[model samples]
Target: MEKMTLPDWMKEAPTAVCPASSGKERKGFLDRSLRNFASVLKRAFASGKTKDGPMQNLEPRAKLAGFFLLILAAALFESWIFILALLVMTVCLSAMTKAGAAPLLVRALPAIVFTAVMAAPAVFSFVTPGAPLAGVGGLTITAEGVSTALFFVLRVSAIAALAALLVLTTAEADFFRGLGRLLPGFFSAALFFTFKYCLILVKTAEGAALARKSRTIDSRGVKEAQRWFASRAAFILKKSLNTAEEVSMAMVSRGFEGRVATAPAGPLGFAEYLWLGASSFFFFLSFGF
Candidate 1:
């Protein structure tokens, strides 16, 4: 290979230009992460604000009831066709919400990929009638085992879709509204603000990671990269913990009483009753399959 030459200025770099050994960038990253994490937590504890047309009218209790019913129905289903149909149905229903089903699917694709990777091996591990593939690790793999794996994939996908539907359709404040009605007196039911802060924490974590990446030098090798990543992670974790404590104290100082209670769903009007019945009927038809 021919020798490559750099511009004259490139070879005359000063020794004083070396990176700071005291890790100022790393310290700055931790500080920024801590501040952001605290802010994120504050926002997360705040109740979800936006609401769309249909979701605005429904009682909080009604939405919660419907959600639990749907989850129960999905869980009871076993057939591949039934599970597939339910997943489609969830996406279809999700369209009525402002967030819509498409966005939900996009957000959930990561979990879908993970589930597929994890479940693929399990399918071929056990033998059943009409085995499709050979067994792994001493067990006889069969067509039945493979199909069973696929069945689980469909099952989880459907469940995830339904959960997504609830997120799009349900308001964060009313989440507690529903929870308070469903499980009154349960301490977990009183965690609406906790959920709010949790979102903040997630945002803080992301911000910290991005800030770290922007400031830190790229490592040269695989092992060095791993160490670099771990160091950054530890920094984030420490900052996040400190941030969380500050947030908790701030909330306590602000008179945040931890209790969630959904106002009762008053007697359903004729239209509300009709729609509720319709939803139940459609859900049952899907459930029966």
Candidate 2:
């Protein structure tokens, strides 16, 4: 096999191009882009934006349980009525928690758009014998397909809303602690590490992005975009891997095994059981029984 030579950066990626910005505007753009990258990351994990609500006061265990039930109900639901009820439930909980409606929509809108993009076409997949509801643009839309599409949209929205509810209600730390309580020791450690490392990785990527934007123009053409992304991804991955190594070394030096140093949650009280019961009731009702 013959060895081949390519650009030195086929091996190097995100932070390799930390060239000086051309002007104050480029510098500001770099700063804002990096900050926005962090902001998106903060949202990805739990953030103060989503955590300032009454739902946050709920026991993490209870919220987790409710989330599971909400997902289940949403999954089993076939009717728009059930989905609407779940949405109403989401609204009520969000209101009670003082989580603003706009924020909830912001959290869920991405999921809604994603479901529409994928599910709109898939709705017609089932070949149930049904009359055409309408026809337009050379496509015959059937009643079954329309109904299926509606069901999928509702189900996805309800599930995403429930997930958002969890994020809105539970702090990342408490969520991990609650998970630690129920799960086996190793599993809990994994969850805690996953939560911890995700932020570190995001920051690493932001630094990488600042470096990249300083060196390259954000062109709209296909080849440019592809080159930009491929190079950035490679660079981000390198930085993230190094960051992980540093974090691991620091943790080890501090005697941090993967296990969390959390105080045990002790025992569940009657209220928790009561909350669990309520979650079950709502889940059943929402599933059309």
Clashes of each: 11, 3
| lDDT of each residue in 1-289, candidate 1, tens digit only | 9999998888884443323333345444444656666664554344265447575467766766676666666677766676787788777666765657666796467678888998776655343456456655776667776777788777778777777666656667666666776676455443754565566556656675565456545434567556756876787678768877897799789885665434555676665565567557646866566
Candidate 2 error regions (>4 Å):
1-38, 49-53, 122-129, 215-262, 269-271, 284-288
Regions of model 1 farther than 4 Å from truth: 1-56, 125-130, 133-141, 185-189, 199-265, 271-289
lDDT of model number 1: 0.64
Per-residue lDDT over 130-166 for candidate 2, one digit per residue giving the tens place of the 0 to 100 score: 6677666766677877777777877788888878777
Shift of residue 237 alpha carbon in model 2, Å: 4.9
Best-fitting candidate, measured by TM-score?
2
lDDT of 1 at 243: 77
lDDT on C-alpha atoms for all candidate structures? 0.64, 0.71
Q: How close is candidate 2 to the true structure, as a TM-score?
A: 0.72
